[model samples]
Target: MGLNEAPLLFNFEVESSENFTFIPMSVRFNLDRFGLRITLAQWQMLPLEDRKLLARFPVDDDTEIEPNFDHALFEMLRTHANVEPEWFTPEEAPLWRRTDSVPEGVTHQAGLAGLTAPSVARWAELDPFKRYVLAKLSRKPEANHDFVPAMKEFGGGA
Candidate 1:
């Protein structure tokens, strides 16, 4: 198969699929984990089908049937966008995968959004991608906040 199925997305990210304007967290998570650096301009340079292919590829443990997802992305960008893939090492120990404690940024962002932060047990219950979404959403200051929607979608909020 040339492409995998569409990876699961947070509700907020689904809107971007209409034009592929913003990168989906599913793709972003994998990019960060795999050390691939795809810029907004670089993403826009690729054809929609290539963008969709990147979005569809899975990075989970269940992805054994697929060719290496990052390699596919790199090749697509190189072939279609005519751009060399930039690389950066991602975190050796990402904070999102921690279950013992909720990150300060997550709690702070949730508090600012007026949402209850996930408790340690609740945090531990999340799949890695969900945890990854929360951590990424909360790690930075942004005018458009998705942390609340993500928290609610993830059942960390009412």
Candidate 2:
């Protein structure tokens, strides 16, 4: 779905019962296809129950849904997935925001301690979630060289 019409993103997790791991049915964007589509806003609003339901959905590295900031989608996500809705903004999410989950004093800025211009440009072109991956991959000093080239290639900077 388009961003304007997109839905909330539900991440599934499996729960174990006395006998087996049960997949809790819930309403979440199915990402068993190409493209990561979802607003960052809706993702942060997900309550515990929503996350639980998402955890139950069959997911793998291939799943490609993202959260957005549509209220309807957020409400639908909660109702359909059995969760309490909260006021969450995309900018408030830590994952979306840059952090030192990498190393302190390190950053993505150019020259001082970051990637090249082409690399940043390429990274800028990527969707936020994909950007997150690139950021994570490039966060460490060891991965900077490879990530810069990869970002440049990814964004067609070369």
- Model 1: how far is 66 from its true place, Å? 5.3
Which candidate gets the maximum lDDT versus the true structure?
A: 1
Query: Which 10-residue window in model 2 sums to the lowest lDDT?
Result: 10-19
Listed in order, each prediction's TM-score against the native is: 0.87, 0.28
Residue range 1-158, candidate 2, lDDT tens digits: 22322222312122121112222212222321222234435444555454444434432223333343233444656665545344332323334233324323124423333443333344345554444434444445453433444445445323
lDDT of each candidate versus the true structure: 0.76, 0.37
Off by over 4 Å in 1: 1-4, 61-67, 142-144
For each candidate, how many residue pairs have backbone atoms clashing (under 3 Å)? Answer: 0, 13
RMSD of each: 2.5, 12.2
**Against the correct fold, how does model 1 do in TM-score?**
0.87
Off by over 4 Å in 2: 1-92, 95-115, 118-124, 156-158
